[model samples]
Target: MHSHTNLIAVLLLTVLIHEGSAIWCYRCTSATPGCGETFNWRGIGYLGEHCPEPDDICVKLTERRGGSETITRDCLSALNFRKDIPADKYEGCRPAAKDERLAHYVNHTIKEHDVRRDYFTDTTFCFCFLDHRCNGASGMQVSAVMALLTVAAALLLR
Candidate 1:
């Protein structure tokens, strides 16, 4: 019985570790060498940071001005430490409402947009909690590692 309990503990730890692994996100902007609209992961290398909260979602903000676009990737926790964004509310990609683009975050709420309302015409926001470094130009629908960990934990619990 004691050995069984130990085994369960190990399994639980493994599952937790796996889940935590995905809490990291690519953190950068178009200004970075390879962090533009088309991310050049190979040349610039991975520039990422871990999320402050486990439940935080990776967010990719794409702003288009006339013909040019800029991309910013980061964790919502990094974006807003004052609050937690309910994952269900922002799990996919959508056009950001005009007023929300420069909303309050604990950090980097807005740059030039804070003063100028005519910064960008089109703003795209994509959110994901799929896996490590999941934030990109688009939000991915599947979180396979999470599913696999859930199944493993369930089987172990059983």
Candidate 2:
């Protein structure tokens, strides 16, 4: 009798945990911090406003060293950035900074006409990362484990 109540309580707690997780997932996916860039469910990557068509624009900005330069790059060129995207929205493929050193190296190598050496020496790579607040997969696994443990305990009592 009391054990039945305990089973019901565990089941209710499991449902609550699942619901909370679902809500958290929704918030994280649609939230500005997450940018909806990764870890999507049901094949939906991002929600809300569609990112404006990208354009190749002359990006004029000052580097960390305070050197100003202009470079032509294709970016999601919306004059008014989307509200849902993070303030410093960085897609992995996009170049966040104008690496002047790299540009100089490329030009120098090109002038020398050393194709193989130039290609290898002048090539520079930078990494961009997406933010993840909650481990969606891990969270689901933990939730499953909790539910399974609850079930196992309930069955053992019977």
Candidate 3:
């Protein structure tokens, strides 16, 4: 009985550790610019999703066109970022500033045949924690881990 209990405790600890290491982030795609309602839309809403392998960062891309901004959020594999996406578009997936949500902004101005066009983009990336809180799937993960720990403790006490 003692050895069996020890084995169970070890298995539970291993599972909890494994689950805790999994990373997740918020994902959303929008046709509208500014993304003011990105987190609050009723249809096709933002989802708390697990990051793919080697995708340790959460990325948000905001494009400004005709004085409006469109945003896309997803998980990105850090090593493949440069190889997969154009450097001119992504710039760099940096972290947001203190008290500020924007990570980086890039602007491009083109002049052609006496016509002037401007393009602007903003990129924001971060770990699961921001402003002292987890913004996405991290919350659910925490809750699950806690419940598992509670159950494990209860079983051990019995």
Candidate 4:
């Protein structure tokens, strides 16, 4: 009975923690270690820091050309998009707009090729709002652990 009770408490705590706040998302650039084109999820809490403010979403911008790639991770609110979409309330990735893609190619000295042929460069923007308190192996957020422990302690005392 006691073990089952503990399990139930833990489950409740997990849910509460998952929905507590935005989340401690990893913010970094390709320049930062482990945050390159191919991300290392294990480095989630090992580097970078939290978003400037809470309640914001996480964003990953990747610009690719031929064989070169650049990646950046930051809060969604911190981005400045030329054209806006329904990003504020949803989570997903989208390709850059036509004008934006043309601008990117022009600025980078690349050419946006024909649809049937090879495109020199492309830009993809990804956004997400994580609700996981403890995603095993991917690294757990500190605040989540603390909240879980606190709630467990309170439950034990009561």
Candidate 5:
């Protein structure tokens, strides 16, 4: 009986560790959009690279694109192109809208990684275990193991 009880406790502890580790991994290394907000990458390569956080890829790109002169020009162009900003939004000298070019620059800046979905899967796995349905069978293996332990305990106690 004592041995069976110990077995059950061990199984439960294993389950707890698995679930906790999955949740922790989901939050820590995952490169989800919300996770990207934790840093100030300025939404440049947020959807791409899977580095730690607040990567300076965008900063480097801006520096390479004619530095301050190009950045200020792009900002002025964006203000002019924005239909809702009104003509009064800019001081003078309207530059052509370079939205397409900016988008191309941003997209080409970073190599994409698939880390976000992996973390999402980890989170889903955590939820499944918590709800007692780890693999769509409703924790049948767990239940079976517990039942076997119970029966064995009863026999031993008898």
Candidate 6:
């Protein structure tokens, strides 16, 4: 009947709304050799994952120890993203305030030669837009909600 048709239309609209609003970002971790062309790859070492929350931002962390280096990439909270870049940094992610020594994220060590001369060094943290794409909601959610309201009105009219 007409009610069944309206239900189908609403469901289809809901699916379209969800699909258009979905946001995804790259996720990965690498050490020594580093993750090659992280933005380009899609499998194994690099993965495309959903950015679930509103404040999620893509993060890249690099650590250097004598000759070796380590890198990690993932979606992280923007509240912890710092502005000040330090010289001779020893932790992956740190607070913007210089007095704070707590690292917001990952921290690890490296050995200069075999396991004899192990040393931990400072890390550099960088935040970038997810795939240089998503800039948050972009009013898509609002539009979807409006669409649902329209569908409800149409049903009521019938």
Ranking by TM-score: 1, 4, 6, 3, 2, 5
> Of the candidates numbered 1 and 4, which has the greater TM-score value?
1
Answer with 4 or 6, whichever has the higher TM-score: 4
Position 148, candidate 3: lDDT: 91
Query: Which lDDT tens digits does candidate 6 get at residues 1-158?
Result: 77878777877997776565534545555632335333334234443576667545555666567877665655654324433444323323452234233443435553333232123355556554523222221223545677699778776866
Per-residue lDDT of model 1, residues 44-113, tens digit only: 5764677878687788878889899888888876666322233344567777554444344535555754
Candidate 4, residues 1-158, lDDT tens digits: the string is 77667777887897887566556556677776667765675555464455555676666777788888878777766775434333444556787545444334333433543432234267777766653222122333654677698778766756
Model 2 over residues 3-122: C-alpha lDDT tens digits?
Answer: 888778877896666444312222222233432334344444443232233221111111122342222111234323322222443332232323334334454434557332222222
In candidate 2 the C-alpha lDDT for residue 87 amounts to: 40
Per-residue error for 18 in candidate 3, Å, reads 4.7
Q: Candidate 4: TM-score?
A: 0.54
Best by TM-score: 1
Q: What is the TM-score of each candidate against the true structure?
A: 0.61, 0.26, 0.40, 0.54, 0.19, 0.40
- Model 1, C-alpha of 54: deviation from truth (Å): 2.8
- For candidate 3, lDDT tens digit of each residue in 69-103? 65665565532432223333342444332322222
Better of 1 and 2 by TM-score: 1
Worst 10 residues of 1 by lDDT: 81-90
Question: lDDT (CA) for every model shown?
Answer: 0.68, 0.34, 0.47, 0.59, 0.30, 0.49
Model 6 stretches astray by more than 4 angstroms: 1-23, 31-47, 78-119, 130-158
